[model samples]
Target: MDRTYFVYMMASCRNGTLYVGMTNDLLRRAYEHREGLAPGFTAKYGLKLLVWFEQYETAHAAISAEKRIKRWRRRWKLELIEKLNPRWEDLYPGLVPGPA
Candidate 1:
């Protein structure tokens, strides 16, 4: 099966604490963060809202994007999120398998 990878960012709130990560399963990983199943920075900082994401064909590319985003200044990161999600709305609902 073909695999897809994602470099995503989660935030506690608009312009709040942010967390950048990469995952092959964006929905599952985002769910884990929402439910506090994955321990560490995200859970500790309440960064459970899926704010931004980019898909990649290769894991290497996803990882590289995640790393690059993580190193970006807070202003840059915020701008990135705003560009795609101006309201900073939680994107987790769209990823879930259910009625929209």
Candidate 2:
């Protein structure tokens, strides 16, 4: 079965702590982070804002992108986020589906 993979960036706040992750289910994973269900760096630092994300057709490509971005300099990551979200707004609400 075909499945989608996502590379997403979460942050505590604008110019705050950042976290990179990959998941098959973006909403669920992001929710888990938001709820502090997965205790770790994100929980410790409160990185609940989804600053940026990209979808991939292949798992390999998604994994590669996530890995590469995780190693990037903080300034570069910030620039990437600003390109998609100038104000560093929480994108989770926008991603959620509207009522049918």
Candidate 3:
């Protein structure tokens, strides 16, 4: 079976700093930090909020996009998100498998 991949955006809080990464397991990865199971920049910087994520068919493609986005200026990244999510809301509230 093919594994699913995700290109995710995480924020410090509502509109704090943003971080982009690619993961094969979006839920588990997000949960890891939410539950403090993972450590590093995200956990250290308190950037556990899942603001946005996009599914990709292949990990390779997801990773490629992630690296490209990471190279983008902060202004560019914010503009990209604003175009899709004007409010900069926490997208996980709706995408996560739970109540709102």
Candidate 4:
């Protein structure tokens, strides 16, 4: 299988908190967030819905993008998501399949 890397943004819900992160395995990392598996800021802030994501060929690139996004203000982040995901929907459910 080909290795994939992702710089992703997760939101608590509509017009809610946002979290930025990077991972080599997008699916696994997304699942971790959704399941609240890791005890960290995301869990504490209830940021679990995958609102936006960008794929990269290398983990370094993904990490860089993640850092850039993290530095952005909340309003800027919201604008970014709104540009692609206007509804701010939980994109994770659609990515995996079955019931959301």
Candidate 5:
């Protein structure tokens, strides 16, 4: 089976603190953040809302994208998020698997 990777951004709120990361399982990672289970920066800053993400076929590409975004200016990061998620909604719900 082909594996998928993702570069994602999370925030404390609209126009608030931002966090960038990469993961193979977006849903699990988002859940960890939402539940305050992830350690370090995100948990400390309460950056639980999934504001933006992009999928990649390779982990290398996803990691590179995440590293690049992490170095971006705050303005550029905000602009990127707004471009895709204007309202800055928590995208966790949509990522969750539906009940069987």
Candidate 6:
């Protein structure tokens, strides 16, 4: 079966620390980060805002995008987020699995 993959960017706050990651379940992964369920950088830095994301049909493409974005210069990454989310609003709410 075909599955959706996501290359997502999470942030502590607007123009704040950012993180690039890939996952098949964007909602669940973002929820984990928001709740600090997963240990490491995000939890340590409190990067819970899902500021941006790009969907892919294949894991290879999503992983490639994640790695490339992770290596991007901070300025370029910021520009990317700004292009889609000028205000850098938390996108998590919109991705929630069910009624809010």
TM-score per candidate: 0.95, 0.96, 0.84, 0.88, 0.95, 0.96
Give the residue spans of candidate 4 off by over 4 A.
Answer: 97-100
Residue 80 lDDT, candidate 6, scale 0-100? 98
Q: List candidate 6 stretches off by more than 4 Å.
A: 98-100
lDDT pick, better of 2 and 4: 2
lDDT of 5 at 49: 96
For residues 38-66, write the lDDT of model 4, one tens digit per residue: 67988998888999998998878888888
| lDDT ranking from best candidate downward | 6, 2, 1, 5, 4, 3
Q: TM-score winner between 4 and 5, please give it.
A: 5
* Model with the higher TM-score, candidate 3 or 5: 5
Clashes of 1: 0
Record all residue pairs in model 4 with backbone atoms less than 3 Å apart, i.e. clashing: none
TM-score computed on alpha carbons, candidate 2: 0.96
Winner on TM-score (2 vs 5): 2
Candidate 3, residue 24: lDDT: 91
Give a tens-digit lDDT track for model 2, residues 1-100.
9999999999999999999999999999999899999799999999899989999999999999999999999999999999989999999998789998
- Candidate 3 regions exceeding 4 Å error are none
What tens-digit string does per-residue lDDT give for candidate 6 at 3-99? 9999999999999999999999999999999999979999999999999999999999999999999999999999999999999999999876685
Q: lDDT of candidate 6 vs native?
A: 0.95
Winning candidate number (TM-score): 2
User: For candidate 3, lDDT tens digit of each residue in 1-100?
Assistant: 9888999888887567888988998877888766667788788888777777778998889989999999999888877777777777766656568755
